[model samples]
Target: MGADPTAIVVGLGLPSDVGTGWLDDLTDGFRDECDLVGAGVAGGDTTRCDLVVISVTALGDLGGRAPVTRSGARPGDVVAVAGRLGHAAAGLALLESGHEGLPGPDGRRRDDPRRDDPRRDGRAEPYGSDERREDGVAGLVGAHRRPRPPYPCGPQAAALGATAMLDVSDGLLQDLGHVARASGVGIALDPGAFTVTPEMERVARLLAADPLDWVLTGGEDHALAATFPAEVRLPPAWTVVGRVTGGEGVQVSGRTVGQGGWDHFRM
Candidate 1:
């Protein structure tokens, strides 16, 4: 007997890089959950193979569990997320602009001050070090190229009596809008609650972009966004970014937030 064809098809359709090493990582990552099911890669022609194609499928037993879907959200739930934001967007900006280091506060320089310069006070500046900037840039680049999803977070939310859940593939505002529309509710996000990490703030400054915009508008984060009871004890990793209301749409700071999700057509 061989692996099931349906399983192979499903695996290939999973949301990850197709031919890249990411596929292997994904396979290995899910090794314990279900058997690989099936996998195949094909490439080549009589002359030269210009393209590679891979097909995979996966199948799993429910183990007597209920299924979940996008329409399960409800009003009065506390909206939360598990994962970092804006790193990928900041990384893409750095890569496109050919910037070598992470973004930083205005007027800061990488090298230490020269001691003997007449214009210098000869005092060491107490700003961030080079290592911190480098780490920030590297993290942003990794986020852009490959986002790590909180796979366990979703299951944990369900187990913790969550009313709804979703993956943040679009901008935070846009994904929240989906939940709001689905649950027949509205959402309000606190701008102050969303903090930009140091590296992201630097990148935003370098690009002359607003750090808040980057945090709200960035997509491809792959973080798990979920809604739980207002009184529920949220996990430490989860951040309570917003709240669901009984209204019909979504808002940020009392203003109607726009939907700017991933749209290949618009691009």
Candidate 2:
């Protein structure tokens, strides 16, 4: 928290680069991405490393509002999520199958590995020829590499009488599980309520993957998930995906979700 109550201080740690260009690009991205949600970098340190490893510390201000935590949810609150989900995992599928039509920074570089890969001999990428930016895959690709969080929605939900809130960094169910465990309440999710984009569906078909799995298990979407009072009218940015219920864990539809959240130590 800052003296201004709305200002946040961010500290960034960057790997040392042999060339100044990568550092410059990272700095610009940090500035632009942070500013996208009204955050500013205070200061930090840089050091040499074998690969780029960035550690960021953010001190957020709640503008004098009580902090919304995982423990605030209640059995009668309505569950909600802001923004889309599942595209990041789909984008990973495209990149892995040589459909990596993702353009280089600022849309300058384009590589057709199908036409150039000596091993494949002109075999097209797994997903057919539409890697171009206009083909709609760009949304998934960009979101995976550079996530845009629904920053304003956090405070907005808080103001709207939300009972609990958290960022969906890990898989949705996994993060929601945290809230459920912390609040000592159970969560019931409606799979039908998730917003599945066309690109996500397309990639899911190609990979023989379930888009619902991605929506539930995919990480890095950075969407805000919260529980508001059942009677409070959520703002336009919020989507009620489920409800708080009596139980000790999360259940989607009628099935209990196993302990499937991300764990770095276990992985």
Winning model by TM-score: 2
Clashes of each: 11, 0
Off by over 4 Å in 2: 1-17, 102-135, 260-267
**CA-RMSD of model 1:** 11.7
lDDT of 1 by residue, 1-267 (tens): 011212223213333334557555554433322222222322212222334333433343333445444456666778787877777777777777777443334544333212111113322122122124334556576567555555556557776777777777777777777877777788877777775887777677778867776667688767777888898999787899888877766666777765443231121
lDDT agreement with native, every candidate: 0.59, 0.70
Q: What is the clash count of model 1?
A: 11
Predict model 2's lDDT versus the native. 0.70
Q: How well is each residue in 209-266 modelled by candidate 2, as lDDT tens digits?
A: 7788778877877888999889999888899999999887888876787754423112
Kindly state the number of residue pairs that clash in model 2.
0
